[model samples]
Target chain A: MCGALNPDELTLLSRHTRQIEHPSGEELVGESTRVEAYDNLMRGVVKLSKTLEDGRQQIVGLQFAPDLVGRLYAGESPMTAEAASDVEVCRVPRATLERLIERNPALRKRLMDQSLRELDEARDWMVTLGRKTAAEKVASLLLLIASHLDPEAAGERRIFDLPMSRLDMADYLGLTIETVSRQFSRLKKDGIITITANRHIEVLSLAKLQARCG
Target chain B: MCGALNPDELTLLSRHTRQIEHPSGEELVGESTRVEAYDNLMRGVVKLSKTLEDGRQQIVGLQFAPDLVGRLYAGESPMTAEAASDVEVCRVPRATLERLIERNPALRKRLMDQSLRELDEARDWMVTLGRKTAAEKVASLLLLIASHLDPEAAGERRIFDLPMSRLDMADYLGLTIETVSRQFSRLKKDGIITITANRHIEVLSLAKLQARCG
Candidate 1:
């Protein structure tokens, strides 16, 4: 969610934020915990997930650096949030953040714009959940990862880091780990993407990947 | 999405509202058209929907009396909003509402609460989209309609009104119209819910409906 933040607005928001860091695999917010603070990520990734009664885990949303987390002024959180990598965040107390937003019209506008964008992303995920095939889902997930790594690299052949494990990717995409692995293997077999041992992926054929995504 | 509103907040929100009547089958916002204003239903119902390139329609969400429409400050709507019945709405300019929210912290909090609730609902819908069977989908949709009709009548057996057509229900459940009809027939045949001539439904057995919903 890009914001049209002038320097003045940016400075105002920054004034209210405090820097905080968490090591990889640390729980940022636990399920049923009172959401006292909200953070805008300065660096690294987090996964927002929920577990079912049968212990099946589902990855609901992912927060990249610069994305917001820990629901602003929400009463309670239904899911758990954890840092998937070494994470740096700028945290603001719920009341302070609310006060700032209420005072600054531009900040409020930016927040509303971000909320709308998140809503659109959720709706798009609905399409994937409802109709897309496993291969298409894998392709879409890769496309998301590639764009996040470098938005300009979306149309180019470039190496990108895969932030999450195959298990996390499987949960996020509503597929089994085996299915995710199989799809990645199929992509490599078709000369669409090259995977490195260190979890780096190179897009060999962006158009072909897009075709598989549909 | 219903909320408890104090008299002052309710009056302030209702102050600039103008009620307009819309018959069934009226489109409040269409695809590709820029959304100019947000609306709140004063009476009746509205359905939010989107259509695929192949003409497959999906009802993304529904709005009841006292529910807000359009993205709060967004100028263009991603989904079409249509009158599911002879509906009445209080339309307000986006700028005015934004200003009102900026000035009133309570109002802003209420709006954020609503958005978060809607987000949670969307996530629950994701579970259905990703996992539930067609029968479960239809059952879930019917229960949602039933609850909206009367929030307090959860345990009691009761009949409720259907604001939309079979086709609309079908779209919302991501099933064929025939499939929806068949599901209703099966439910009625099995004594779970009874359907009357004007699209009215009576859940004869709540337990049976709940069982089918899973």
Candidate 2:
């Protein structure tokens, strides 16, 4: 991991950094566009997606708070990044970042660590997408969101607000909206979760949810 | 990418680095095991895979010559790294590699670049796993291998040897072996490719294969 940056390096980075906000469903970066800056998400979530020539789209990744937003060393964005919710991010121009990375070894190492972590997460998600059943995929996604929303929650029951819509959830989980909805209802009837109005979900039993994930 | 390490740093790394070989089908690193070293594949192909408790496995990524073999910062190996063909690697201890990264900025930048590249590839594969049909997936895999094996081949016909077996191809494409074989037959029947003995493949029409990938 990037160990630490000196004060001068930090000051140089801060001088080039600017904060920006986007509303829900806003496109942060369009696919194949020239990447101008790196955005570090300060709040809310973003979905990274790609679309085929025939208009089929797949949500490849979800970026949460503190996740870096752009690909480094690439001339153009490979996927479209859209704001899943109202989000705030600190943006640094790509040129400025490259300069900072050249001068600050710690920052470069940190970026490398971030990329490796993302790669690991992407590979894990491939397993879910390729091998898991629809039910298991939904359960895995819920568990992912629950843990991301509250990392310290270690109890029998937990609750979190769904950050994205059911349609987005279907895209992320590689299922149809009806299938996702049916699975949710099944989980609710099975007493594994309680879904209230406005996309609020309370996981009644972590054990049961994990069982469903299998 | 550790670009042009200083002579002293290079010597230091080389001192700790040793060439090792693994036979095809040998497991190099087991999942969840303690990672002790970093491997730089010098020859042949390797597959990084993960398996479920139910014994379902997915080949998440394929590493070819000159690709790094192990995750840097993580303690436990998240996926199993297996030799897809008889492979040789330059093995450097994790501690040594970390020290090299810390002391050599160029090496660190190179590594960071490598990680970012891998992340990009992983996201691309996620699209294939989540959205592509079985035939598309098989075509995509073929295209991937064809391009990797011979990037300079721009003609209508190209030939390359597949490093892995049908089972591995099925796992990587998220399809049954029967489906993969059937697709190959379909492609052959359609005059898209020719499958020779010893897993050799000749792509008759690259455009047709690309069309199938859609």
Candidate 3:
């Protein structure tokens, strides 16, 4: 988010942020609560989700390293945020950031750019959730993770650890755990993706995977 | 979005806008096109959607009066915007707004606020798409429209025209037209809502409708 700022401004903003570490599965922010701080991820991942009153949950977005992790100007967060893995973050006080945003147009623009990008992502995922078949949904999730790790890569092989557990994947995809498992097996059998040790994944042909994501 | 500007600034911004009217079924913005301008809704509703390569489509969002209609900074639009009803919009050159956003902090803040709000709404809809039942989805759509028409209303009767056709509702709810029709009939039979002329609806009990949203 400091990409738009000069070195002096970047230094000024960093001085106000305090470093914090959270273990996997820690609740960093609660649903419907007043936001006190903005956490900028320096390592690992965080999952953002909302739960209905009946306990039905959906993972709406995921944050990776170097991403800012808070809703700005909304006063209260509409979703709960959990540390999806052991993570390090720089916690900036909400007031401090708000003041900076008010005074610095570059800082505000950078944050706005992030917000716009996130909005685009959320809308794309809506299409996936609303219209995609179960198999396509799984492939889309993999494609998202791989693309994030390497934005310009296509038709290339990729090997990485699935950042989310099967249960979390189910929540993210809006599918049952059994369906998620079945899709994984099907993908493996189809020579699209290979699995090892449950969470490890290797995309044999990203082009093939993308074709299936319709 | 001119809400945050002073009178002089508002006039300055208004001077750059041209009024345009689109009848129902007009395409305000095409998907995957280079967006040269932003349309500020001065009149009616616009449905925003994305279609897959093989013809599958999903309506990602709806825009009402006083809403700005276009993606900013993301050079190419990720979705299409179509007029859901007869609409009037003030068209402003995209570059003009870009310049204003760069120079005016309040204008930047206003637009940022809208983006953040849209992000929250999108995430909430993700839960609906992924987890909500057909019945709940139907109820949620009604509740959204009713609540938008009157945010503080509950337990009271509301009479309004359905903004979109049954086909559009089906697309928005991620259900088939038959399923959407059945849900409407079920709601009417249950006395939760009453329909006349197909497009006119009377929500008999908003509290019941809210409860049914799940």
Candidate 4:
């Protein structure tokens, strides 16, 4: 997010950051809990989710490298953060980052812009979750993962490991796992995508996939 | 959102603002259209929506008096804003506000905080859209309106005009108009709410209404 940071600012940030690696499925931070560290993700993916008292879950957001994960202000995090894949993070103490942000307008503006972009993304997904058909939802999620995992590969076939499990995908899309799988099978039958070893996905055509996302 | 502005800053803001009044159903901003002004709402409600290519529309956000309604950064608006009721706004030139924000960190932080709050609300609504039942969706929307309309009336009956039409409610909840009407009737039959003139809604018991929001 701090893509505008100068070399001196980068050095200042590096002084406060400590690198850490986490395995998939690790809980980086719990919902409604205070956070002591603000993670600047260097690699891998993270999933943010909220759970109901009865255990129904909804994955609200997915974060990739260069995204920050923690409470921006104070109080407690409203969503839980979990590692969706083997992840690396440059974790900075919350207070240090907060102090730096207060002093550095560049840092403040970068974070603000990032938060606004995330807000826009969240609203877009609201349309997907609320209005999209089940099959469309599945395709949209696939398109999302494909686009983000290999953003530099525009208009090219996408091949990558699915960052999240099928169960997690079901939760994210507000569909049953069976329904998600059925959509995947339909997509495969239509020659739009291929799956191997369950997690590996190869999108045959971005155009065809976009059509399915409708 | 600039609640922390000093008297001098408020004076400066006033100098840059021109009051405007709009009737209900007016389009304050259109999706994908460039905006010359940023509106600082003075009274009434505004509904922001996104429409799909096939004409399916989803209400993404609702803004109240004291909220700003315009492009924060320089780009075409991603959503359409329509007046939910007769509304008043203090309109400021976009360039003026942008310049002021660039020069004032307080204003910047205020907008950032507001944006973050919006992000949280959007995610919360995602959970409602993804997991909550149709009945719960109806109840949750009612609760949201009641709470926002009269925050001081906690633990008491709530009486206010419904801001949006039943059709709009259906769009927001991702339900058919018939389903939304049926749910309202069910709530009325159960003595949880009373609707008059198809617009005035009197929540009989906020506690019972909240219980239904689950």
Model 2 stretches astray by more than 4 angstroms: A1-11, B1-3
Cα shift from native, residue B156, model 4 (Å): 5.0
lDDT agreement with native, every candidate: 0.77, 0.86, 0.89, 0.88
Residue-level lDDT of model 2, residues A1-214, one tens digit each, is 1135677776776888888999999999999999999898889889999888987788988888777898888899999999999999988888887887777666666677778888899999999998999999999999999998877988878899998888888888778899999999989999999999949999999999988776
Q: What digit string (tens of lDDT, one per residue) describes model 1 on residues A1-214?
A: 1264567656776777778899999988988899888877878999988765556666778877667787666688878989999998888778867766766666776676666676767766766666567998899989888888878754548678899999988888877889999999999999998988938899988888878766
Deviating ranges (above 4 Å) for candidate 4: A1-3, A6-12, A154-156, B1-15
Query: Per-model i-RMS in Å?
Result: 2.3, 0.9, 0.7, 1.0
Q: Give the clash count for each candidate.
A: 0, 1, 0, 0
Q: Give per-residue lDDT, candidate 3, residue A143.
A: 89
Per-residue lDDT of A183 in model 3: 95
* Residue A112's lDDT in candidate 2: 74
A1-214 per-residue lDDT for model 3 (tens digits): 6666678777888889888999999999999999999998899999999999999999999988778898986678899999999999989999888887777776776788888888999999988998999999999999888877657655579888888899999999999999999999999999998899998889999889999999
Question: What ordering of candidates by lDDT runs from best to worst?
Answer: 3, 4, 2, 1
Residue by residue across A149-186, what tens digits does model 4's lDDT show?
A: 77888674999888788999999999889999999999
User: Cα lDDT for residue A204, model 2?
Assistant: 96
Error of 2 at A65 (Å): 2.1
What tens-digit string does per-residue lDDT give for candidate 2 at B1-214?
3344777777787888898999998989999999999898989999999999999999988888777789889999999999999999988899988877787766676677677778888888888888888889999999999999988987898899987888999899878899999999999999999988949999999999999997
DockQ of each: 0.35, 0.78, 0.88, 0.78
Candidate 3 Cα deviation (angstroms), residue A105: 2.2
lDDT of 3 at A120: 94
TM-score of 1: 0.82
Please list all clashing residue pairs in model 3, or write none if there are none: none
Cα lDDT tens digits, model 4, B102-195, are 8787788778777888889999999999999999999999999888877788565999988888999988988889999999999999999999
By lDDT, is 1 or 3 better?
Answer: 3
